[model samples]
Structure formats: C-alpha cells, structure tokens
Target: MPRWPYLLCFLLICGLAQAQSLYLHSPQGPLRGGVNEALGVGYFLGIPYAQAERWKAPLPASGWTAVREARYFGNACPQRGVFTTRLGGYLPPQSEDCLNLNVWMPLAAPPAGGWSVMVWIHGGSFTGGGSGEPVYDGSRLAAGGAVVVSLNYRLGPLGWLTLPALQAEDPQGSVGNYGLLDQLEALRWVQRNIRAFGGNPQNVTVFGQSAGGMSVCDLLASPKSGGLIHKAIVMSGGCTFVRKLEEDFTFGAEWAQAMGCPGADLACLRQVPLSQMYPPEGSVLANVVQRVEAGGFERSPWKPHLDGAVLDKVPLQALKEGRAAGIPLLAGGTQQELWGELLSAPGDWTSFEVRAEKVLAGKGKAARALYQRLYPERPREAWAYFQTERTLLCPSLEAARVQGEWALSYGYLVSYRSSVFPDLGSFHGIELPLLFGTQNTWPAQAIFLSAQAYEDSLPISRELQRRWLEFARVGEPGWLPYDSGKLLEMGSELKITDNPYQERCGLFR
Candidate 1:
C-alpha cells in the first residue's frame, strides 16, 4: 500500500468533516455551502434572498450561473451603531445590499417531500437588527429534525419612509411597507429554495421576537402575506396598537427638514447619510420614546403603518373582521417586560405613581387607582406587574383572543427569572437566550444571565427550544387554544392563568 494513497484518503476525510462542500440549484441560482459533520448539519450562509431599490419593494434575488459562496454571514442592513451597541453589539457591519438569508438543515437528506421549515425574522423595532446576529444562529434548531432559515430586511428611514414623492413613484401608490415587502420576498424565496435545503415549504412556520413578532402579526393580517406563511409564533410583540400613515407630518416634516429635503423630495431624502437618520448623539432611546409620546409611532422615520396597499387595516381589526390569514398563532410575552426599571426601588411609591401615571396617560387615574387598590402596600410588585400586564401580557392575551375567532391561538407568559439578575425577572427579550439556546454565550451572559444562572436556565432553555420546534413541526406545542382567554404561564412552573390584567385591559377595550 502506497503512503501517498493513505495521505490522500486522510485529506479527503478531513475535508469532509471540516468543510464539506455542497452545491445546489435554487430558484435564485446555484449556491455553494458548507457542512458541519460534527453537528450533523449543513449550513448555507449569506445567500441573497432579495434586492431592494432604497425605499421600494424588494425584487427577487438575481439568478446566478456560477456557484455563489455562502460561507460567511451577510452584511447587516445599515443601522446606527448606537442601537446595536444598546443590544450589546450582536449585529454585523452594515450595508444597503443586505437582503440576504441563511439556511440550516440536518445532514441527512429529506424524506419524500422535505423537512418542516422555520423562518426567523429578527426584531429591532423595525429600525435595527438583521439575520446575521450571533444569537440567531439556526444550527442548533436545525439539528433538531428541521430546516431553519433567517433573513434580513431593510430598516429605519430606508425601509419605512413615507412621502408623496415616493408614493408617486409607486404605480400602485403604495409605500411605507418596504421592510414588510422584504419579508414577503424572503418567504417567497423560501418557497422557491427551501426544498433544495431539505425543507418543506408547504409547512413553514414564521417565528420572531419583539418587532419581529410584530412582523409576524402583520404578516398574518396582510392579505398579501396569505399562503406565504403557514403558522406564526410572535414573541414579546404586541398587536393591540397599530398606527396609520397619519397625515400629520410631525415626524416626516421634522425628518425632512433635518435632512434638507422637502416632504415630496425623494431624491433629496435619499442623499441624506444613514448616520443622519439616527437620533442625536446619546439620545436614541430617549428621543425615540419622546417622539412616540409626541404621537409618532417610531423613534426613527421608519415603522409599520397601515399602508393602504400592503396593510389595509390594523392587525387587530383585521383579525376581528376575519380578514387576516387564517393561521395558527402562538403569542407570548415575558413576565417583566419593562418591569426591571420599576423594581429598582420597591418603596418609592411617589416615583411609582409618577411613572404609572405617565405610562397610563389618558387612563392614568383609573389605572393608578386600580393598581393602588390591588397591591396597596406592594407598590414595587404592583408597578412591575402593571408594566408587564399593560404592555406585554394583556396585549398578548387580547391578540390571542381575537385570533381565536379566526384561527387556533395559544398564549404564553414567560415568568422564569434569572438567578444572576433576579430583579430583572422575565424581562423583555429574556426568552431570546432560552429560545436560541445561547445562554452560555458571552453576549447572553453579559446582558441576560450570570454563568451560574445560565447553567441553571439550561433545562428551561432546552424545554423552550423543544416546545418551539415542536410547534413548528405540528402547529401546536401540546397546549390548548386560548379561546377562553386562558394562557399558559411559563415560569418555574407551568400552569393556566386567566388574563392577568383583564380589568386593566377592559379600560383599553
């Protein structure tokens, strides 16, 4: 036996294990990808799903003859560093040509048709976030007997800007939903290419957290998104308040004036740099909230609005009217939501009242009185619960209730708290670590849990992943529909609970 032959065999085996190359013809074009034999998964990274023309609807990915490399992650859609930094810097370099998607599939080939598919839409309030974030790695989820896909869409002013000049450019006179159109384009891409990656396009599940979750609701409501997605899991995103493209130009006018552009000057607006679209230095969060309080729906000039074309009505209204896509829904929220901020001083009833009054606004007197009556001596707990119930819990319950009229809707309240940041409770987005199974990662540790806490959360994380994957596989996570407005509280223990803020929600209703 020749040593040369032995060396050649070793090299081949090593190549197969380290970077097993795979080539496939997809609807867009032939793509090249790598496989992780150790994990028993195949990875196709940074494949362009669509192309965008600034603020216009996205076009399908251009076909290619040569095998396009999908080894590295795609460029993140252009957004301010401040936003990503606030999120603990999980996003990648920004680019306008960032409408890319990634795929993960089991090493084994699909059976008759294909494996069930889970498409992820990252959330950053419709202004930030991309598919390339480290937490969104789909390998672990894909390894569990499914194919997973994550995609990027436009954000901020580039994605959601509305102007008469831009609308004039549109033959259909529809604008302001370019980011949503990007999502639709990605789903269409999945229908075309996912089968090649061992995924069943017919049984697709669209899942996302925060703004991504809101996107899921929008997809469910929009007539255009019908049949593109089969099931939806909306985490930490509410559907109660939907805004219209209000004729009042408080934001649009201010933004245009700041950019030295007229309300109708699309070209002039386009020339303004990406950095200019962000709020003034160190005031992103405050400015955004202030603007939103001032009657704008977004911190930036971007956010989903009831565009007559893509979104004809509010999602809740659509669901009520049975105009939304009749798809199974799993809507959930965290136990704390913005409760962490309120819990810092337990006995500060004055601060609590002030904050509570501000949060309740028009209904402040009623909410304050009800909250004070419910937990008179426990202002801290009351404030925390008030934050959770009003923003996350009640909205989710209400959304589920409306969805029940047209589809099977399940509601969950994540109450698992972190041993590291115990006060944080099940704060907003706490489920990301558990859901992504990234509790051990440095980013997750820094923001979400301590090492010990992460270890402690492993079981819950695994269970959460299992439940989500199960739901993706079969439109149910072994839970009953929330027809009666009962929800599963996912905490140290799982039990059914009536809407926590049914009375408070009644005020809104």
Candidate 2:
C-alpha cells in the first residue's frame, strides 16, 4: 500500500506538468502560439469544448488521454449563409463542426487572484456571426486585466429548429433552442475548465449585442442557465423577439413532412442537407411574423422558442415574477436610427413608418406622444431613425429599471452623433465600433458614423472602454444603478438624466 501511494504521487506530479504544456494541431498543420508580455496575455484559439455527430445535437467532446491541440478553429457548424467571408472583409471560412472557443489569459505567469472572466457572445442576428470576427480579438480585453473569451456556437436553422418529433426523441425531451443549448454547453465548459486558463469558474459575465443580446436574455430567464454566469451586459436586442413552442415545432414538422416524412419526424429533418433544411436570403427577419407563419401565433421564423426546458417563460414575465437569477445586469440601446441601415436596402419610408407604429403601439401611447414631441420636425427619411428609440432604446431602459432595485443595473444612452454621419446623428449599430473602440475599421455607411476626424468622442471611447474593463473585473461599471429618478447617459457626455416615463416606454415598469 505504501509503494502504491508513492507511485500515485509521482504520476500525479508528471500529469500536472504535462497538463500545463501547450501544443497545436491546426488543419493547416502544426503552428505555435506563446504568451505576450505587453498585452500580458496568452491565447489559445480554436479549442473544442463540445462535439456533435453529423446532424445531431452537440455532445460532450470525446475525452482525450493526451493534451489536445486547441490551436485551430474547428470547422464552423453548417447552416445557411453562415459564411462570413461574404460579409465583406476579415471573415474566415465556414464548416459543419464549428464547435470551438478562444481564450485570452493574462501574460503573467500567475496572478495572486484568479482572473475575472468575460465571455463575449458575438451577434449576427442569430444567423450569421462567429467568434472569428476580427473585431472580437480577445487580446485587448484580456490584456486589460481579465480572462476574455469569445466563442462560436451553432447558428441559424441548425440551431433553433423545433419539431414535435425532435422533442419526442429528445434525451432531455426539449425542443428547439439547440444554439442556446450550445451556449449553455460553452458555459459548462467555462465552469469545468476555465481554471486552467486562470479564470475564476464562479465569476463570469456574459455580454453581447443584437441577437447575442437576445441570447443573453434567454439565458438570463432560463432555469438551466441559473448559476453559470454572475453578470450580463446586453447591448441592442433584448426582450423583443418572443416565440411560441407549437409554432416553431409545427414549422419544423411541416418542413420535415415536405421532405416526405410525416408526423413528429425529426429523423428525416436531421438527415436533410442543412441548406435544404434552412433556405437563405440576404435579409434579417424581424419579430414580425412571416406571410407563411402569419396566420397563426404559433409559427415564428428562426428565433428562440417558449420550450419549458431552457426557457421557462418570456423575459418580462420572468422579471416580474422574480424568476431571474438576480445577477447584476448592464443593458442599453443605441440612440436613433437603430435599424435604419439594415432596413434601407429594400424598404420604403412608409413601410418603415408602419414598423414604427407597430413598435410604438407595443411601447404605449405615452411613448408615442413623447416621441412625436421630441421629433416634431421628423424628416421623411428620419422617420426610421426616431423609430429606433421606440423599437429598442425605451424597451431596454425599462428592463434596466427592473434590475436596478434588486441588482446593480447600469444603463447608458449612446448619444454621440456619429462623426461619419454627422448629418444623420447617431445611427443603429453605432455602438459596435464604439464598444470595441475600433473606429478605424468602419465600412461605408458605418464610416459616416465614425468619430475619427472629430476629437470630442475620443475620450468617450476611452472612458467607455475603461468602464467596460472595470465591469469585467468588478460587477459595477462605476456608475449609480439606473433608477426611476436618474439614468446614466452614455453620449459625447456621461451624466444623469430623467428617465423617459411619459410614453410607451412606461409600459415596461
């Protein structure tokens, strides 16, 4: 027994040394990455945290006896137009097994305390984004003093597919929300192995914009996601896109039936070519029901569903009932023209006005009157711009109110009129470049919204980054929790302002 104990101790020491060693096995073949001193970070990209059989749900990665090559980005999950290479520049490639994540650890050998963790979920309307986006480089955030991570999860049809048969066949008996499941799995990965990367498994903040923000809301409301994260930062989209279980499930079933299999037929759905499963278009679908699914409330196109497993209820209800985990939450929306550029390509201003009315009606009459008074001189083209507040800003502000009393709730209004489109004022998606502080990388319309030539917004970007870094380390972003009386304004200036209470925005409370 004494001899066996000695042997065990010797083996444990060897394994520890081997576990700390790093290597690479990229598809392009072997390569090496090392620790950076200036950035004070070490990054290992393309680490696999989960796996899936072809056309099947993701499974825990096969355990390996040896240290794994976490060096290369695995092939991205298959879906329609997930190919970011077409989004213009800096997009990598795509694939069917893209279950991977990237890590950024402090450059130092060992810090006194485990580094704080910030896991960013990239947003591309839930259909077309990945961790591979260049702007998502984790080194900057990690070097700023936390273990920053960005990851890839299944997206689009491959993710939210819901069918009765799939549910029937479910090992967990849950339907739809596979992409969300993938996120939960990633969080599980962080909880289980992040200590190896110098991250405190217990402390984490999940942050994202647009669809990623929507995902954050889903997770926040999900029972399955209860203790995985300590805080959340929701950028643009949140609590807006709601779905029904039957509608999504029925749609999945019809698609399967059209493929010659009928009745709760998940087997057939899984076998179909992914492209055939989810057709692609050069557009982002809003919460509006489609012409096909419009007839019934049950049919929603490619969004999270009201399945009882992961998401038990919608965000607003969950918040009111106090089902939320009560984690500190920081959420905000960009100022005017939020969805303008995205909607401009094909639609007319009248159609845009119709969208505005729908969003306002949902917000309430008080918001409508206040919005009209604020934008009394609304230009024909600018109609869409004002709608941004109704559709996004006010809604998010109200959500901040809910968390303000119980948890630290900080809100900011992105009001710096973009230097690029100084004429248009601040526009939609303006927060992206600003948050990443990558103003130099703007595209055509995005360029118009840049703060480049103008010197005023420079300090704002720096300050915002500082606050974000502070949030990454400590829960508060160094501001008073937004309250009914005072709200934080994140513009060319940061100050307290009266909450917008006289409009549809009031319905949120």
Candidate 3:
C-alpha cells in the first residue's frame, strides 16, 4: 500500500540492473545495445544519425568499421541549464556534436510488417533539450509493443543562427534551420536503417511537445519533409507563428554585437567559442531570456525561422492554402499554460476588464464579455482560462479545423490539473510523463504530482499512453476527428465535448 515500494521497484527495474547485450547491423554499422530483461526491451543509446558542422546542414553519419557501443546517451546540445528537463537532474555536458538519436526495440519478435515506430522530439524552446532525459526513456514504451526513438539536434545560436554573411558564403544559400535539418536527416536515417531494428519505417509517427511540436507543424507545411512523417501528434504546440529569415538575422546581428564581432563577419563569428555565444547562467540578460522562453507565452529568439529552402512560407498560411503535407494530425494543448496564473492576477471588476481589453487587443469586447459571463465571480480564473484559449487552445483549434478539412485530424485538451501545482493547472509539458508512463520516475515529485494524487494518477497515465500508442499504430486514436467541431477532452471523464471557447476563438479569427 505504501508508495515507497512502487518507487523502489521502478528504480530497480529502470536503473542499476546489469543489462544483457543485444546486437544489430544497419547501414551505419553494427550497433551494440543493452537489454532490460524486466521490460523485455533492448535499448540502443546515443547513436549518431548524422554529422553537422556549425551553421551547416547535417551530413549523413560516417561509415563505421567496428561495432560501436551504444550503451550510453550521447551529448545533449549546448544550452543553458535554466530549464529543468524531466526530473531536474544534472544534464550531461552539452556539445556541438549532439546530432545523435536513441532507439528502443521490443525483445519480443515483431509482427509480419514490423512494429510501428514513434520518433519523439523534445521541447525546450529549441534552445535547451536533449534526447537523454530519463522521463523520455523508451524502454517502457517499447515493451508496450512499438519501436521508440528520441533524438538530439543543434540548439541555441548554433542551431538557428542566421546571418547575411553566412548566407552569402553558403553554396546552398540556406541559413538558420540547422536543427530542423538535423531532424530531417534523422528521419532519413530511420527510413534507411529502422528495418534492422524490427521497425517499419513506412509506419513512422512523429510526435513532440512544445517547441518540438512546433517543429512537427513546420514539417507539416514543409515540402522537403513530405513522405517522411506519415502520422503526426503535436502536444502543447501552438500554431499561427513564424518569422522571416531577415527578422531572425536581426537577432544574429545583436548576438554578433554582443560577442564583439561585426554582424557581417562570418569568419569571426565562427571563430568565437561556443561558451561565449550565450551566457551560461547568472547574467541578467540570460536570466530574462530564459524566463521568457520558459514561460511558454512568447516566441524565443532561438527557434526555427522561415529559411527559404526549408520553409517557403508560414505553416498556418500553407495549411490554409492546402499546401501542407496533409498527413493525419493530432494537435492540442494543456488546459492551462504559464500565462494562466498571471492572467488570473487578483483584480477588481474594472481592473479585470482593463486587463482583458489589453490581452484581447483588437478582439477585446466579445472575449471579455464571454469571460465575464462564464466566471462572473472568479474574474481571475476566467481571465486565466481565457488566456489559455486565446494563445494555445484556440490556435490549436484552428490548426485542427484546417487539417481536418483535408486529412484525418484529432484534437484534445489535457484538462487533468496537476494535484501538485494546483495553481499552475494542467501546465505545459505536464502530459509528457503521462504519455511515457513514467510519472513515478520524475525526480521532482512536487512539480508533477502530489502525495494524494500519486496512486490516482496511474490510470490516467496508462490511458494517455494507450491512446498515443493507438494513434501511432493507426491514424486514429480511438477518437473521431474534429470535423464536427468536437474535441476529446482528456481528463477524469474522457469524452467528446464541443470544442471550448468557440465565441472567443471566432473573434480572434
């Protein structure tokens, strides 16, 4: 009955157990992995799918002569240690040589067509995330009968830097979007090599949360990325946002000035050490930037911008015009995001109306009236809920509406509030552990679950994983498409409901 037993059992199963060796030969070379007997899964860790130089597209991994040991995770992309991934543990030393991926294969024999593959792209504002986090450990998912993958790409200025000088120097005339290129390269690797790991490359499903989810959206609209991602799931991913290459280059110019180099000096910029590009921690600028990115409220400087080659135009516009890849899409967000509490700031009727007016801007009157009508007494809660609708939920609805018109599409709202951080509501990235079925493995329990909700959360976790795996296996996740303007609200009662905030969303549109 005690929780300690469950905790200890999970630790014993996931860690400290001596692993059995497993081997597989692929295009790259023979890879050596470790088997978790308890989970009946084999893990191939930290395998490089490509090699990438700074400010350049990734190249295929070099040929290997010997059996490479893939028993440990590769380096995470260079990033500040501001955001805590998964358990908030110490990360492995960051590196530029971080274009690696991890794979998990079921020990059980595959079916006739091979197991379905799900590639996970992590979220850290495109500046701080790696595939090595424990919460993303794929052994459990593999055991549930699928091939799982997580990968690391370039991050920060290295991943998305744009400069007129660099563009001029490049033969391809492409600048920025290296991180996205790394993802494409990884998918190509999967197409070439996943068959060796008992995975059907043709049945691949790409899914990610937050920034990674935004990458999925980009891929949807990118002609270069077509046929690679068969099915897609975008979790906590916002839509209707993109930047021009010129706009992004301005940030590069600022970065150049900060580094004491001329904005147009490509050679000088390349010569600067990675450490000096971004402050690691403790600096005022770095702290402010980290806070804003972490808030999940605004676009961070380090993100995939509209490079002419990779992305011809904004994804939303592409989707609207039916230029998007038109694959099956599952996109939605949490019930409450980082702006919820701030939007819910204590205020009188007049102040609440003022704040609503400022937030809604052009569409102020209707949304504010709806908020007042919905939560007459709880003005703060109403405003907070409205903030989520305006920024995340409604945009996601628009995405679903657009995709559903042409392709099989599903939408969900993770309405299960965290018992731990009740004030934060469902919060961003909260669905990750649930989807991975690793909520208990989170090192910081307070951030994920409360003592009272620990046991109660397991069923929810299981259901979420089941639905996601279902979606990966087939295009459908046991839910109807949002064609009827109904979304599956994932909470204590998982059922179809009319999509929320229709009136407010209409005003925004």
Candidate 4:
C-alpha cells in the first residue's frame, strides 16, 4: 500500500476511537461528553437528571430523542453570590432551571462488576453553591478507579421555604424540603442511568461537606433514600441538627410579611421578584447572631426541617431509632473549623475569658476552670477550639456515637494547616483541595499552597483519595470503626487517636 494511504487509515482509526470514548447510551437517551486529554477522563457536564415546578417534587427529566451534548455546566440555581476564600470568589450564571448533574469517569474500560460511584453534594449553607465549583472537579478522583458525580439542587427560599399554603399544594403534604427531595430524585436517576456510564448502581457512596453533609444524614434517615445510598461520608456537618416544621412555618409567616404577603399568601409570595427574596447582607448577619444568642446555632430558616412527609421525624431522632442501621458511615471535621472567625474578633486573653464565661454560663465555674486549664496560654486558640467543639466536632461525635452503636462508623480529624496560610490552621473545608487533588491547580486552593507546599502535600492528598476510594469500593475506610472509640487523624502524620476533645465536649452535653 502507498505510504499516504496508510497514514489516512491510521488517522481514521484514531478519530473513531476518540469518538467512541466520548459517547454513552444513558437510559434517558444518548449523551456525548468531553474528554480531558491530559488525564484521559471523560466528563459529561450539565446532564439534567430531573425537573420540577416551584415548590413541588422533582420529576424525571423529559426524555430526548437525539444525542445530547453535555459539554458545558448548567446554570447555577438562583442565588445571591457570596465571596469566600473556599469557593474562589466567583459564581456561575444563575437560573431557576438548574436541576442538572456532572459526571466524570476513566476513559478506560471498567473493571469486573463495575466502577464504584461517588456522588458529591456541594455545600453553601443550603443557600448557594453549585456542582460546577472548580474545587469540586471530579476528574482526578474518577481517574483513580471510581465514577464521580456532582450535582446542583435548588437553593434558598426557592428550595426550602415552608408554609401552610405550600403544604396544601403538595399532594403528599411534603413541604420545606424541596432541595432534599431534589437530591433523592437525582439518586433515583443514578440508579436508572449510571450503569450505562460504566458505574455500579448497587454500590453508590454519597459524600458531601457542610450543608451537603447534613443532606447526607437526611438521606440516611429518609425512607425514600433507603436503596439509593449504600455508603456515606459526612464532613463538618452534624447529624442531630435540624429545625422543626412548626418553626419553619413561623419563619415563613414572618418572611411572607416581610415580603408584603402578610397572610402567607402563596400566590402573592410566588409573584414576588427573585431580587427581593435575598435579604440584605447585614440582615443575614444579624439573623445569624440572633439565632446564636438564642442558643440555636444549628438552626437556620433555609436548612432542612422535619417536614412530616419528607422527614417524618428529626433526623437525629430517627438515627437513634435505627433509621440508618446498616449504612456504613465515615464522619469527621477539621480540627480548627472556626479558627478563621477568631481572626476577625478580639484576640486578647481577657476577651477570651469573658466570652467563655458568657458562653459557658450555667455550666458552672468548674467547667470554665477545666477549659482554661486545657489551653492556658493561647487565648484565641482556646476560644476557637471551644467554638469548633460546640458547633461541629462535638455534634459529629454525638452522631458517630449513635451510628457506632447501630452499624459500622468511622471518624477522622483533619489537623493539617496550609503552609501558605499557616495562620488559618486546618480551617473549614481545608480538606477539599486535597480530596479532589486540586491543591496546586485550582485558584481558590492554589493561593493557599505554594509550589513547595503542593509538592509536600501530594502524599497526604494521595492518601486521602486512597482511603475515600477504598470506602466507596467496599464499605470501610481501612481503619477501626468508631465503635472502637478510636479515629484516624490525618495531618503531617496519620495515626489513630482516642477520640480527642471528648472531655470538653462533655461539658457542653
């Protein structure tokens, strides 16, 4: 054969292979994905899993007949953007029609059985955040032998508002948990469609951080999510925290009044412009302070509540009553979750003492004395530690204790501080970059890690990914369960510790 003819044949073969790698036949229809040539991972972005009208349950997405090109991210659910160091200080385009998901898988053929699946739910206090956050790119994790999926659910009032009128509109009488319902629908979509993308439908691990973690716990408790979730990971979110539906009704009434619909009028409220829904920044902070001062640190109007239909009881109560009995759970928080807050507050020893006395009121002087003894010199560190324990760590421990009694549970504490911003310590969500292997690349994380720091942290990142992938594949993260009263600590060194801070947590309990 002629040399030119041979060259043309080779090019044709290469093109066919590339085309085949980017195509998959999902249950809904055919999909064409984009490939990350560098990593050899195929990513299908903005795949609509379900759709819903305002304040109603999500329905399966309408089917399409043609090949759908999932090459770009869908619109972010409507939200008022907030700049944060963790989210890289930007937001994507927003819209009400944002019930879409993104998936990443290795281009190579699946192993026997199929690749394990991990579904990520991003957190923005249940108000903001979408699946398209750069830090959440799942290509790296998918390349490591698991299918990674990230999704967007409804947010803010559009997702979680509860009122008597809205309840009446729902046939099942479910209200105030539309965001959570959206997640359940997404899982159902996975069960019906993931196998087409080379994933094992029977082995799905739903993992999330913050608000997303809380959703994981809710899923574990929801009867609707029984077969959809096989394993779960909750990061920096407590299982026990949720609002009563009655509380939401009261808040809804007040919100309605604020929005010029004094009777909680559904039609009027629905007509209210989206721009008017977002409260002023100052008002939000004030509301948070009021809730904290009233000792409802975990309660928020926008968070999931115990709606009778969607959630028959408080999530923690259900868990204690064996709602998530057989589901293996890995739960933990960063060691310095609230340490960044201290940077904006007074750091004097006297201020710390005063704050402790006020916060520990009624607990007695003995408790205060013990706390002081625990951190005699570092006043700011002591206060930050106190908040971290009360708000996140202790609640996590309580949830782990209940889960440990019923099924396999493991706990961890991330104590690694970023070398680029050592002052922040292991602040909230510091583990995200390492878990996604984006520390040196994503701008939000790269700003906090120098070239040397990224290199040094590579081993820790790899180890974290390994454990998570192992947990998704099987049911365990390779450490003794929380039933053993030991948790694996990750930092510069990884070792098992006997559940640190229990004594201080006991003071609050």
Residues 357-447, model 1: lDDT tens digits: 6766777667668878888888878877877777666676677778788888888888887766676677777778777776655466664
Over the stretch 386-445, how does candidate 4's per-residue lDDT look in tens digits? 888877877676677778778888899999887887887888888888899877545555
For residues 79-130, write the lDDT of model 3, one tens digit per residue.
8643665347646678888889999988765766778999999888777878
Whole-model lDDT per candidate? 0.75, 0.64, 0.77, 0.80
> Candidate 4 overall Cα lDDT vs. reference?
0.80
Error of 1 at 261 (Å): 1.8
Question: Which pairs clash (backbone N, Cα, C closer than 3 Å) in model 3?
Answer: none
Compute the lDDT of residue 330 as modeled in candidate 4: 91
Error of 4 at 123 (Å): 0.9
Each candidate's clash count: 0, 15, 0, 0
Estimate the lDDT of model 2. 0.64
All candidates: CA RMSD (Å): 5.9, 6.5, 6.5, 5.7
What are the per-residue Cα lDDT tens digits for candidate 2 across 282-330? 3333221133334421134667777787777887567656666468888
TM-score, per-candidate, Cα-based: 0.88, 0.81, 0.90, 0.90
